[model samples]
Target: MSSDFEGYEQDFAVLTAEITNKIARVPRLPPDEKKQMVANVEKQLEEAKELLEQMDLEVREIPPQSRGMYSNRMRSYKQEMGKLETDFKRSRIAYSDEVRNELLGDDGNSSENQLIKLREERAHLLDNTERLERSSRRLEAGYQIAVETEQIGQEMLENLSHDREKIQRARERLRETDANLGKSSRVLTGMLRR
Candidate 1:
């Protein structure tokens, strides 16, 4: 790897490790300190993204023969970044849940109040599930209606086509009759002349 590429790779590795450490520490810290750490990790993640972009540019400049190895390394780095981001997101969610529990005075303990809360949550979930099921049924009914409407439209189009063919045949027969009548009139006129 070129010197600049190596530098970017090293920076990415260091930043990724730092972010991972911060994510691990987030759950253990107080809410105020955790927020600051989360912000710092987010900013580092951005820097890591920029470094990856730089590495991509560098990879493009590399010769094809040696590029495969570097490309694999780049993919591995990206996967690592993805894992880090996922970890950070999970950490943030856990922190938020903790704060919400604290605000609700749950104190991570089970009690009568907790049971009531659980029942309420369960009821809410059941309501949402019923709503979703109703929506699904409506969608299915609509789909069936659309299919039937399409079939009706197809049948109408077929009938119109058949009618058009019948009209064309009628027009052809009318023209033939007109020609025969003209011939018959001419023959009678010749006889009258004679």
Candidate 2:
């Protein structure tokens, strides 16, 4: 495979492994450990994203044929990464809800007041989690679309560069013809004056 493909594949593999490790360990982690794990995963995810951005910039510098193939592959990789991030966040929210519920302790049939309070709290958490999920998905989709569009734009720029070269040549020819016409005009004027 091409070096670009190999680099992307390697980065994806590392990201997958890190995410898998975090998910596997999350359930078993104590509160502090869970917090630390989440932080680590977030950091690694950020690094992966930066790497992807750099790759995108490099792809723009490459020729169109290879760049298109690499861009498509990168787009696929980004979609998968987005799904993984969503899953990670969902897992964290579920875990937090479970902890909160355990702390709240459901006593035998609660008084109307207690029941209402618990219901309100649960509803709030649900709303917050839903919002988080929606935002995550939207952001991911927007980012992927931007990357793909940028690749298409770069290809268009390459085509424009070629057109620019042709225009420059045409301009030079026009200038040369104008110079010859100017000389002829000066000679005709001189003859008429004589």
Candidate 3:
């Protein structure tokens, strides 16, 4: 195996172990910390995915005779990644359930609990609506910027076209001047000969 391949393998090992440790720690963390840890783990998982792709590409570049062992290792790594992702998801679900239970309490079916749930839902909807409105405004701003950029580009192209036409006219004048110079030289030669 190439040194680069070995390096990537080592990096992947360390990353996966780190992710696994983070996932395990999520259960013990406070709600805010758990959220942050989960986000970090998710990002690490994406990095792991990229490393796996790099390893797979590296394996493909090796000789066919040597490929079988690397291929097996790749399969094992993929299975490990799958298990890690599943564990991460399970941890997230467990955390969510814990939060939900804490919020709903033992009398989850009571009228009071139902009213609380309704208010929470309403607030969540309001937050979503505000986020959507903000997103729409941002999209409008982006569209306006794009339109202005296109107009600027069009004006630049027009300026270039005008410059090209001016150059062409200058070249035409130069040719006419050369022709007149040649005619003047011939007339002078004829007069000298006479």
The backbone clash count of each candidate, in order, is 0, 0, 0
Instruction: Assess candidate 1 and give its lDDT.
Output: 0.77
Q: Quick one: best TM-score, which candidate? A: 1
The best candidate in terms of lDDT: 1
Per-residue lDDT of 31-73 in model 2, one digit per residue for the tens? Answer: 6787888888888888778877866776777787666666766
Q: How well does candidate 3 score on lDDT at residue 112?
A: 55
Runs in model 1 deviating more than 4 A are 108-194
Residue 182 of model 2, lDDT score = 100
* Candidate 3 deviant stretches above 4 angstroms: 106-194
> Model 3: per-residue lDDT, tens digit, 47-136?
999999999999999999556556766776786788679778866875686577668664546855775665456446444544554465
Give TM per candidate.
0.55, 0.50, 0.53
Candidate 3 yields a Cα-based lDDT of 0.76
Better of 2 and 3 by TM-score: 3
What lDDT score goes with residue 179 in model 2? 100
Global lDDT of each candidate: 0.77, 0.70, 0.76
